[model samples]
Target chain A: MEFIFVLDILGVVAFSISGVLAAMRKGLDVFGILIIAFATSVGGGTLRDVLIDTDVSWLTNMTYVYVIIITTIFGIILRNKLNYLRKSLFLFDTLGIGLYTVVGVEKAISAGLPPVICVAFGTMSACFGGVIRDILCNDIPVIFHQEIYATACILGGFSYFALAYFNLPQDLIFIISGLIVIAIRISAVVFKISLPKVY
Target chain B: MEFIFVLDILGVVAFSISGVLAAMRKGLDVFGILIIAFATSVGGGTLRDVLIDTDVSWLTNMTYVYVIIITTIFGIILRNKLNYLRKSLFLFDTLGIGLYTVVGVEKAISAGLPPVICVAFGTMSACFGGVIRDILCNDIPVIFHQEIYATACILGGFSYFALAYFNLPQDLIFIISGLIVIAIRISAVVFKISLPKVY
Candidate 1:
């Protein structure tokens, strides 16, 4: 549990930096950049918590708030050096989504929601933060574009249910599910694979 | 209670149409238009419900979903003739914020949040749908721009608290608070009153 918590914080930090970079690319002010960073790090989990009728996770734990603040400042201070770290940041983001997907699925299952809704919730938890971030930045969400982002989460969600149905151990299920998400995302990016355009 | 329910439905319809119009202006497809309409109609209330840990209002009663469907179809069919009804649509939109603000404040009060949070929730309920709508359409929210939109809701929320403090009747408080919102919004538009740009 401690290990998962540490990974979660790392994910939040990675997403926060990603948001700061996006905001800086758009030349937003300091306040706007910080807000975007916060949204990118915690927006998806917040949305999932709300939908599931749970206390907002951040409100219950001040650690997430402090993490966002610290990350935003770190990201802004290191803006000039970010280009060199793009590959590392990308790896962290992929790992973050993997952890986020498992956490979302586990929460929904605990709430006794149906499997399909659980999967939906998991995908939403992993992807909606970026959706919110993109929206606030006045751009169409990248996930809604040709990217395989949400699709990777969805696949991992289905994998979670399949593994659980086979009576897999809980810890193994979490590890396998997270690995599947990371694998799919990395594969898609490396191969330049994307969903076909509808229009 | 029946009157409030009726007013709520009217507000939903008005916001749904507003969303459809916005999506159409952006040349979104049918699915995109309907999604925007749904978001604009129920997005605010859903946010409030989630934050307060209540069953989502729309999921409990299917009426909201049906209303969004009907409103979307109606809006798209009447799109060509909508230019002539801009003033009427604006009036409906204003009345919507009025009802929404009151409903949101009442709900937050029922949930036993602080008065400040209640007011914030009220303002969010009245205005966040449009904020979501604008984001989906790839624009900065109009309320965040120089518009007096959220300001009107904040004023109405404060008015509700003031009226309640005076020991006003429940119905009277609701009506007066709603009217305050409507009046402020209409006056702002008529007088070209707007917030000054900070940047």
Candidate 2:
């Protein structure tokens, strides 16, 4: 449980930095940058919680809020330095989504949602923050245009259920499912894999 | 109760039309048009419900979905005609926000939220659908840029509480509060009133 909590915080930090970078790239003011960062770090989980009628996770606990704030500040200060560390940032983002997919799937299952909806919610929880960020930035959401982002989460979600079906230990389920998501996402980027567009 | 139900449906239909028109104007495909219509009609109320931990309104009752579908089809078929009838559409949009504000305020009050938060929720329920529509269309939200949209809802929310404080009947409160919003919005359009930009 404690390990999952730590990973959750790491995810928030990773996503917050990504948001800050996007906002800075867009030349947004400090206030706009902060809002974007905050939204990107929490938007997915907030949407999931709302859909499932759970208390919004951040409102119930302030740790997420603190992490986003700290991340945004550091992200801005190190903006230039961070430009050279894109690969590292991408790794953190990959890990972030991997951990978040498992957390979202578990929450939906605990809420008694059907397996299909649970998997859908898992993908939503991992990707919707970036969706919100891109929308706020007035750009076509990257997920809609390109990238294997949501697909990775969906794959991870299926793996989670598969592992559970085999009666894998709960802790092992978390680690293995998260690794599946991370591996798929990282390989997609490294190998330049992308879904074909209809048009 | 029946009257509020009717008003709720009206609000949904009106916003759905607005969304369909926006999507068509952008030359989006049929699927994109329907998605935007659905989001614009339900996004605000969904946000309110989720924040307050209530069952999502549309998921619990299929009527909202039906209305959006029907509205979207007619809206598309009547797109050219609607351009000439912009005034009527504006009136419907105005009434929709007014009724939505009252509904949101009442729900928040029933849930025992603070008065200020209730008023904020009221405004959110009235405006955030359009916000979602704009975001989905990859544009800066109109509320943040131009117009007196959300301001009218905020004014109506305050009026609702003020009228209630004076011990007005519930029905009269609804009528008077809604009128205040409609009057403010229509006049803003008529006079071309808009919030000033800082930069």
Candidate 3:
């Protein structure tokens, strides 16, 4: 439980960083940056809670909101000193995707959802934040155009449940699943991998 | 039940018109207009349903999708002739808010939710589409900054339940509530009225 909490915080911070970078790149004001950061940090969990008929996660936990604010401030203050915001932002985004996907799967399983729905929720939780961020920034979401984003989350979710069925330790399962998502996302970005356009 | 079916179609067309106008102002291509129109027409209802643990309204009704596409095509073909796009867009937007607020309230009431939550759902259904549209267009949501936007929906919802509780005739209640919403919205825009900023 404690380990999960730590990972959740890390995920939130990573998402916030990515969101701030996206907003800053668009030259949005402080309010806009804060809004994007908050949305990316908690958007996935909020969507999951709403779908599962629960109170919103961030509303119930003010700590998440505070974390987003602090992280946004940090990013704004250090942006001038940072030499490569793009690369760092990409790394943080990948980390966020992996962490949120696993946490989403865990939450869905706890709610007694079917495996397929759990995987769907995991992918949605991992990617929908970036979708909103891109939309708000007036850009096409990179996930829709550039890489195998949601597919990585789906793959990780399948691996997670498969390992669970094999009686793997829970922590090990989470670590392995998260690593798979991160690896797939990084490889996809580096190798110019993407889904074919239906049209 | 038949009345609801008819009203649902009307509401879809009304929302789609506003969406098309907004997208046209941006000079979007056909695909972009379709996406924007679809989001504007159904985004609020989708959010409301997801929050209430119901399936998204459009995913079950292909007619809504058709209506949006048809509206987008119509808007594109007649763009140059539609000098009154701004006026017509406002009218359609107001009508949509009136109809959707009542529908949202009715759905929540049918689900046996408390009155306050029903009111909230009504306002949410009436406003979230514009919120999404603005986010996607890289503008601050009009509701967050301008006119008596969400206030009109809330008032209309109150009028609806108030009349129903007093055993008013069904048609009279619906018409009166909807007219109230339209009146408030139109008046606010014409008079350049807005809620005072809190900050």
* DockQ of all models, two decimals each: 0.16, 0.14, 0.10
* Model 3 stretches astray by more than 4 angstroms: A1-6, A60-62, A85-89, B1-45, B50-109, B112-199
Best by TM-score: 1
Task: Say which prediction, candidate 2 or candidate 3, comes out ahead on DockQ.
Answer: 2
- Top DockQ: which candidate number? 1
Residues B28-70, model 1: lDDT tens digits: 6565576689889988988888778787766446678788889
Candidate 2 docking DockQ: 0.14
Give a tens-digit lDDT track for model 3, residues B111-178. Answer: 89998889899888888987887666567787888889899889888988889899999888888887
Better of 1 and 3 by TM-score: 1
lDDT for predicted candidate 2 compared with the true structure: 0.86
Off by over 4 Å in 1: B1-45, B48-53, B57-131, B139-199
Residue A18 alpha-carbon offset, candidate 1, angstroms:
0.9
A65-111: candidate 2 lDDT, tens digit per residue: 88999889999898889978787778778889999899899998998
Q: What lDDT does candidate 1 reach at residue A39?
A: 95
Global lDDT for candidate 1? 0.86
